[model samples]
Target chain A: MRPSATWRGLLRPGDYIVLAASIALCIAAGFGLWRGGTPDGLIIRAGGEIFAETDLSRARRIAVPGPLGTTLIEIQPGRARVAADPGPRQYCVRQGWLSRAGAVAICAPNQVSLILTGRGSDFDSLGY
Target chain B: MTHSVIELTPTDTDRRIARHAAAAIALTVAEAAIPLPLPGLKPGLANIITLVVLARWGWREAAWVSLLRVFAASLLLGQFLAPGFFLSLGGALASLAVLAGAMRLPSRWFGPVSHSLFAAFAHIGAQLLIARLWLTPHDGVFYLAPILGGAAVVFGLVNGFAAAALLREKAHAG
Candidate 1:
């Protein structure tokens, strides 16, 4: 193999350590999932509402007021999309819809939040 | 043969540079292709190529390939200057620095697989830092999950295998 051919060779020791730190992230994500083990749930906050309630196979196009501004969110049977408007930015619209449990979209700037909680599954709040 | 310094002709050098640029760009594209259930999480697949290039070619060349890749990816994804970009940059630079230090270690102590695992961990660490510093700071510290760390280990191994495939091709050609 060429000198640079070794993919692992290209990485330094510190790289491994740095990458290992993601273990923490993984743990947190898993914890979020574990504690939130039920399907069909809802999370209401100051920004907006996030729910993972029904089957995504029969969703339809729905207009919504995002925190940043006006948006057209497509709620498909199993997917959702946020359309961009004349707001300051449309990054959130570009984010598309989230399908997985615990998946959430929020426009903090606009105090608008969307969460699709698990469906048919109980909402388990580990603590708070 | 291993003890002697590796030499290259001018043409060979040019070809090598071309290959690195091509590979880096490809990896950058690949990295963007994979999506997570969440907006923030990524497998960091492109870092695999960057890691291999850093290990074999050294930090300077790796820097060139990775730096350009990041900028190009950001532009393509329309995520320039977005929090996502900052997270990626912080992780990448930190990984480079870490890889640079590891290069000094005895080769017998590790293998390509180990190197990949190391880089994966580093990327995650820097990502966390970015999340804390730039992204939402409220309860940001909770972002760390052992599952993500485990994913890094697994993905790093997969990336190592990818780099190894490239190596085999290079060896065959050279």
Candidate 2:
């Protein structure tokens, strides 16, 4: 149905004010949340238990005991990665580096996982 | 066993609400069939019926239709009493509250478009709050603010236009 001429008149100054205010609010809040800082450390898990948590600032290499064997994790200045995996696929090793909060890498066969965490990480867990 | 015949006749208002509720529920069910790339993102097409009902029959009838649609849709989708149901319930109640307030504005100042937009934001905002409090309890959930808010605006405009068109058709038919 075509909007009648009166329909266009439905929006008044007050409506525009409300709409503009809400839009601005959303933009501000969204940007502010997006600008949050990066994570500080990585939470490593093996065999469904927390294996270790290492600061991203300190570069180190650690081996975590897993179901299959040891999983090697490397931490750099501001990033972390699964350097090697005893698991068949080496899937975790291929996940590359994780520098941002909420980034995660897992070796399902070895039951080892790494999750980035920091104050800037906004979500507790990711949902698809 | 003895059978007693009983006839229950619904009033015009009841029938109108029933029809509106049914329409809203149909939209909800249809929306569920569409796959969304992200969680907490929906077109909220059923809200169009709420806007139409509020404009035509007032907030009371609209509230009935909206609540009925939520309850019925959850039951049909087998999400009753689940996290999804609570989220839906929270969003519906929050949107209804906003619509109730928005209705106080003069018709010439606020129509379906503005009302729908306000309700859309309220719906998403309430859902986010509920998710944070009960479902996830993480600050990261707020990361969805931009995407969900953007969707709310787009879907709100589309639903509002549809509701306005439906209202015009009703006016013409009457």
Candidate 3:
């Protein structure tokens, strides 16, 4: 078919329906995400229990008892990190800083973990 | 050897499939080289070849070319049997199924643009499903639907216009 000849025929009412529906869905979803807001604080878990919930805006440090020993957690303005861990590998300490909601750091040997919670953050964790 | 019972010659259709598949694979590789802003967000340039082939020949030809492109591209990218390969395969199969169904729609009512849009949605939707089922198994993954859907709408339109332009050019040349 000639390009010019079929140009007018490319779109039909059904096409408009699909486009409109998708646009509506996109807008609604975007609005929802926007309203969801950022996480307010961080949640710390140790030995499968709630250890602490600290406000992200405040700068503080806490030591939580774990299987191996104490796991020190540090929270600063909009960020949290494992300041120190008694575990041998120090994997949790190596996790560095986590500022975004839904970010998590685990010290498996110490049975201590930190999770960031808030609005707008999606996905429990990322996978390959 | 007195006589050969089976013919092993490459027919015109076979040659055409090879050419189209190669072109599509090249496009796929080239696209992979470009850095993406986010994971699972691509312009899907290779789909243009599939669109054109579907329009010029038929769905069967288009399917063969599309599948061949996926396999060849995965092998070349060294992602065969990996998570990436499975995601690509799932997305391609879903899009092909969508295109096949979209073919039944009236040609005047459904053109390259509509077909592209449908296929794009199907591709992303299938990938997300696979990710949820096998990869992540989390509800959080669905949160990306809005972003991915929006991208699909934009790229679907762009690819559709491109395919249409290419088809027009080929028709004029012939």
Which stretches of model 1 miss by more than 4 angstroms?
A1-128, B1-15
What's model 3's lDDT at A33? 53
Report the CAPRI category for model 3: acceptable
Query: Compared with the true structure, what per-residue lDDT tens digits does model 3 show for residues B117-154?
Result: 88888989999999999999986777788889899999
How high is the CA lDDT of each candidate model? 0.62, 0.87, 0.86
Off by over 4 Å in 3: A1-14, A31-128, B1-7
lDDT of 2 by residue, B132-158 (tens): 998999777888988898888889877
DockQ of the two-chain complex in candidate 2:
0.30
TM, chain A, every candidate: 0.45, 0.68, 0.68
**Top model number, TM-score:** 2
Per-residue lDDT tens digits for candidate 1, residues A1-128, read 67555555655464465455545556666666455423243343433454223345565654455445555555665555455443466555656755555556555555555555664333222111
User: Candidate 1 or 3, higher lDDT?
Assistant: 3
TM-score of chain B of 3: 0.94
| Model 1 interface CAPRI class | incorrect
Q: What TM-score do all the candidates reach, one by one? A: 0.53, 0.68, 0.65
Better-scoring candidate (lDDT), 2 or 3? 2
Candidate 3, residues A1-128: lDDT per residue as tens digits? 78675665556667777777768878887787555435578889999999888789888899999878899999888888999999998887887988767888999899998988886776565211
TM-score of candidate 3 chain A against the true chain A: 0.68
Top-lDDT structure, candidate number:
2
